[model samples]
Target: MSTAMSAAWPYPLLADMVLAVHFGVVLFVIGGLVLVFVGNRLATWPWVNALWFRMAHLVAIGVVAAQSWLGMVCPLTTLEAWLREQAGEASHDQSFVAYWLQRLMFFTAPEWVFAVAYTAFGLLVVLAWWRYPPRVARSRG
Candidate 1:
């Protein structure tokens, strides 16, 4: 790598940004279901019933579950790991935020345990879809 490229890349900061994005995705997958159910009951938050939002939420969880069941690591996780390595930093020992986020998302359990958990969570999201279906957009008269 050229010295200019090495100096301009900012791999460590990029890796940290990826970690933060991964954390936000995790939050959305978990919290989105809660909001869907609550919003359905309240009838005050119609945006939660938006088809686009629901589809995105479903797809996000679906990808996670599919990756887990297929025994494949997430691309985001792989990218972050690669970035950290490029920056000459340990995967889980980088900074305080990264360390805690790793601790929260990763566990020492067997692979099958994670597969089962992800499948079950995916099923719950499916159930939520049936329970509170997304609203179809109305055509203008």
Candidate 2:
């Protein structure tokens, strides 16, 4: 049975923990956009349009795009890799969650491809901001 893990990989637990946090961040960045559209059309999920939430989402993706264009790895990914190497190895096969999240988060792609995709996605987020601008709900007397 082959896996992303190598050697004894003693830090499988910590590595998986980092991987889970990374996956959650990925989901927030992607899902937040999806909800912005869905929430607006349905006139539900008012929190989606909150200024703070929108700004945070925008900043999150902006950083990702800037990092890609500048040829920088995500800090979270760097930390996770460091944790894996600390024990000389970590195994993705330690648990079902780890295995699947690892699969979902990683794929082989050229650097330029990622840079372009991130930039395009960042543009879409900007467009969303324009189309469905965020607002703070004020109290009604």
RMSD, candidate 1, Å:
2.9
TM-score of each: 0.88, 0.85
lDDT of all predictions:
0.87, 0.85
Candidate 2: the clashing residue pairs are 9-89
Prediction 1 TM-score vs. true: 0.88
lDDT of 1 by residue, 1-141 (tens): 888558746888888889999999999999998899899899899888889999999999999988988989999999999988887776654878888888887789898998898888888888988988888787799
Indicate the TM-score of model 2.
Answer: 0.85
lDDT of 2 by residue, 1-141 (tens): 335445445566777788899999899889989999999999978889999999999999999999999999998888777776775655543468877887888878999999999899989999999999999878899
Segments in model 1 whose C-alpha atoms lie over 4 Å from true places:
1-9, 139-141
Single out the weakest 10-residue window by summed lDDT for candidate 1.
Answer: 86-95
Off by over 4 Å in 2: 1-10, 90-94, 139-141
